[model samples]
Target chain A: MTGLKKTILGISDMKNLFQSLNNNYSIDLSNYALSSLKSRVEDFMFNYHFSSIDELIHKVESDASFFQLLLNKVLVETTEMFRDPEFWNFLKINILTRNNYQNELKIWIPECNSGEELYTLQIIIHQLNLQHKIKVCLTTLSPLNIERITKANLEIKKMEINCANFERYQEEGNLEEYFTNKANSFKLNPEIIENAEIISHNLFSDKIPGIFDLIIFRNKMLYYNPSLKIDALKILNTGLKPGGYIAIGIKESLDFPGWDQEFTVISESERIFKKIIRKEE
Target chain B: MSYKYIIIGGSAGSFQTVTNILASLPQDFSMPIFLCLHRLKHVRAGFVEALSIKSNLKVIEPNDKEYIRQHKVYLAPANYHMYFELGNYIGLSTEQAVNHSRPSIDISFASAAYTYKSKLIGIILSGANKDGAYGLSQIKENGGLTIVQDPEECQVKTMTSAAISATNVDHVLKANDIIQLLLKLQNKHF
Candidate 1:
């Protein structure tokens, strides 16, 4: 009966209706066009004073921008620096230090949500002292994500170092100490931002622009349907250079479509895969 | 004939599934029960709590070079793996995910099959992927009784189905029923 309840229910119903329509039409929601459509519903929901979610959806179908806002709300923002320590170790050992991508390393960290992963990679680069040497092109599914990363402020600086994770880092000789929170959270420097070219692209619809040396798109396939995972992987395969590496979140794998066959295990436990394409002399 | 070991693996819904299996297990049990569950990155040192909830066997994640003991449950710490070794312990590797799992069931099961041979009883339980299928089959190849949770009865069937499809499973049971199977096997020289 309350306005909040009405608004929530309205959004859910609208999403349900939208999803059903897409399903009926065999629409692939992974496409970039869905972003605009999602926004339209989000905008409609914002204006409604509906008492339930179902009613809110009914009221918001006509208005634009509501669904986008709703999608933002549903976005999962949970991430941490060096979320998995061993994987980074595997990267530092098996790929970063071993490979000659120093001046030419083009890393694409898709779905760089909430700046945690971006900062994480930055920490790795800083540790390896490759910040200015290697160029990393970061990509996200939403423009909002890029904005969140570049606009990352002093609030992050105030955060404290996770002593446990910091201890596990490869401890390369002659690097700055682990990050300290100045206040609120860690304040990121513009230099880190400058080294990385952040972009927004839909992996399922739009093509990934450049050839990448290492692709770390953690948790990319978790939100999608199974078919989308295969499609995304194909695109990823095309963009990655021969002998490049790709890392997924701990939960995801390339089993169904046999993507695993394309990669040699760098660290099978950390989900690191090296593209080992054959070349004829 | 003191060569029985228990191996269990899962993801997504593994935390709760392990709690049930460990609870069903008795303390001071004669055989060693080794467990591996695919965890999110940086899992806390909370495994002992889950294992202590029901079993008398002490539970803890293995250190990088730690030795494994009988009547104790050793969990592959987050981002690391647990492999069975013959010189009185399981070898922990900082290896990457085998089949998308750091503490891959297949890795643990395969190693157990190699070390324990017919004395091992491998069980594949709830999990999202097919990590343990091949490893369980390896255990079966070496003359061990292969027990898989019925895909229809599992909380998540992918791992169990992979196991069933890989080899002729000896027992396909539910979560609670697995405890019965364990007890049944333990009575026979374990």
Candidate 2:
């Protein structure tokens, strides 16, 4: 019982420290200011709560699982397959206008939480009948995603009936009857899932794999600190082929530090940007 | 008061969120609604049929230069944003994410604030990011009506709480109650 209280108090203190750190980064976490100002470090004398936030940080210092745990607790995983219908149509009609099915186009989905958005991209390619033509790759992993993949890939060449509920990518309601149901819920046609590759990687910690023709990192940026966001964007821009397109969540953007000049937004409202390839110096 | 248009933002349970709220409205609902949920830059899917089947409003994945027709819903067509030019054609943008969001609640709300002013109704629903707080305030500042989902009804209140703390919101109601309010606004004096 005492241990639980100590942990809670320790967590509260860490929240304070992290809050302060956030404020320092120019994110106004002003609400905690009054409490922080009133409680001096001396007030912590009676606090048997794990020394300080520093102690907790030390515990997590070498914990590779810390990030994995952080992923499960913090990331948002609510995504549907082929979210915006027309944008897929737009891509077919406007950008990939050529009828050459033999030309290989590469697409990337960064920050692909639990593989829903990545699989959804393949569904779009399938829906547009562009599947046989392009190669799709996904990078990024949240704890929920890693968990989902670990669970999904466990013990079967394919999913079981109940696994449908976990396939938030296949979608739900009204459109349930629109597509063939597999593994249970509205299963994304197996072919679409097969067309794309989902991998575990971090834009912040890992190397930006290679140049691609397109990249999508939707809704994942809003959660990042400004500097982290900038770093993520810089790495993303570096991974883009000269004319590669980069897409972010409806709310995420490239406007950050280290977000050096590279891409211009294709449509500001949709959060789609095209890599603006620079000329030689 | 009646509005020429309405805009909404949300995340998490928002998949069923918009459906549950809008399904109760009339099939021929006369007002135009531009829906902007927090979504990715990947090819958009499922929104049209999911929401369209629930509401009588003609849900469409609008194209660039599509007119903002009355009695219709304009879904952000994916990899793009749905914006208005003073009741003119609804325009699509591939602009950078604002507050790290595309189909940004802020962008849509800001555009409405910038263009429609008092004639717009801006709403904030459930989600994780602090995306629409400033834009909703802008709508209120410009004489437009502002509505926020009651944090209690939200599956995740962090998003709405940010907006609530950020702005002096005009109405805070449960998700169902918000639907009731919108219906009332439709019938009330403009």
Candidate 3:
């Protein structure tokens, strides 16, 4: 393991790197919460043996592949299937089961990382046999992440926690039933994502892909600064149909100004909110 | 020197020590306390309730981006790495765990050290692992005061011993003495 280094980047260094990335790749990370971003940038420097932020910027400007790796390193990907079992249970019983859809129920997972959450959602949909009635679209900034998630190979060690969470979420089945054990890892059944669409999209810089009934944008916003958070929320609001449901991480809240006016809290504990429909004045 | 933040990190056998420290502080304690104890990731509810029982000051697991308040105790939430952000707000992340622990002591302590610089007090208590050692070193390097529970008096000595080995920690005190030092600092006697 690489030893963690002291944070060496100052505010100006971070701004320069953000500016370089924006100019070269059109990637905008200016609004990420600074403290965590600084830590990650320092770690990246330490791991890759770069002594200065300018060296990192030079590499990012010169190599697109290295830039992709940087995206993978910078983005948070620590997620597990069926995490926060109580929230999953609430989502199943109170939201998914209760919603009555006439056409297809469109569910969007923006900034989908390594597919743990997507697989978890798919398992519930598979159990309910709602595959035909639902369409799931996953959007992420990293194409490598899209490939990795599509492959769906997970560490065998993680199964203990994953199984524990799955058991807590539902009573009857074993989580192991969903995957085939390999020598060192488990591969999720390909059928789980057979109908799911994976796209390389950036929520911050791109347009809203389509209107959706439910958006599971969990935990990703915790990285954004206040201004970016509100901007991202507005994009989510526009993509979600009025009366649609949006679920954030349990520890995340929609407490910023204008949130209450546009959305109503469905479950305060679980952080589920419903988009409010208002008549024109 | 006056302190603005009191950050504590512990695991394994440190709970009672922390409870005792929190139990000793009055409701109007001036500094905001940040506790980054290693906890079961799946179970989140009972720990805060258990700590709040003995604490005069309110003990909370703050939501992500929530503003920090003086006179309250903040516990790093389970399954997330807690950071002290700019503008005195709490930041949470589901990033990869460090030293096999989420709500990592190293991450929280380092962040606090960076944010508060010399206006921070970092303490490490009884625990079974070396998780907080690197973080305590960071606090010291940032010119903050550092303390480790007296290893001989600790229920588990590995954590404090590692911290002492990692840096020139300022004090190695027993549980009661640690509490007294905090109270002295609170009363502006230190």
DockQ per candidate, 2 decimals:
0.04, 0.04, 0.86
For every model shown, the clashing-pair count is 48, 28, 0
Which candidate number would show the highest lDDT if scored against the true structure? Answer: 3
Overall local distance difference test of candidate 3:
0.90
Best of the candidates, DockQ: 3
Ranking by TM-score: 3, 1, 2
The DockQ assigned to candidate 2 is 0.04
For A1-281, candidate 2 gives per-residue lDDT tens digits of 34432121233564664555444333222221111111222123224344556654443454546524432433444454445544444555656665354558887777666655565455556657877788887775543464463233222212331234323334443323324654543444456566666677766667876678878776565444444556677788778888678777654546765344666767766667777777899
Candidate 3 local lDDT, B50-126, one digit each (tens): 99998999999999899999889999999999999878999999888899899899999999988899999999999
Best by TM-score: 3
Model 1 docking grade: incorrect
- For model 1, the superposed segments whose C-alpha errors exceed 4 Å read A1-17, A20-53, A59-63, A154-164, A170-183, B1-41, B44-190
- Model 1: per-residue lDDT, tens digit, A124-215? 78768877666777777667777778865534321333334555664543112443345455556666666778888766567677898889
lDDT of 3 at A41: 88
Q: What does the lDDT come to for candidate 1? A: 0.65
Residue A89 displacement in candidate 2 (angstroms): 3.5
> Cα-based RMSD of the predictions, in order?
14.7, 13.4, 1.9
What would the C-alpha RMSD of candidate 1 be, to one decimal place?
14.7
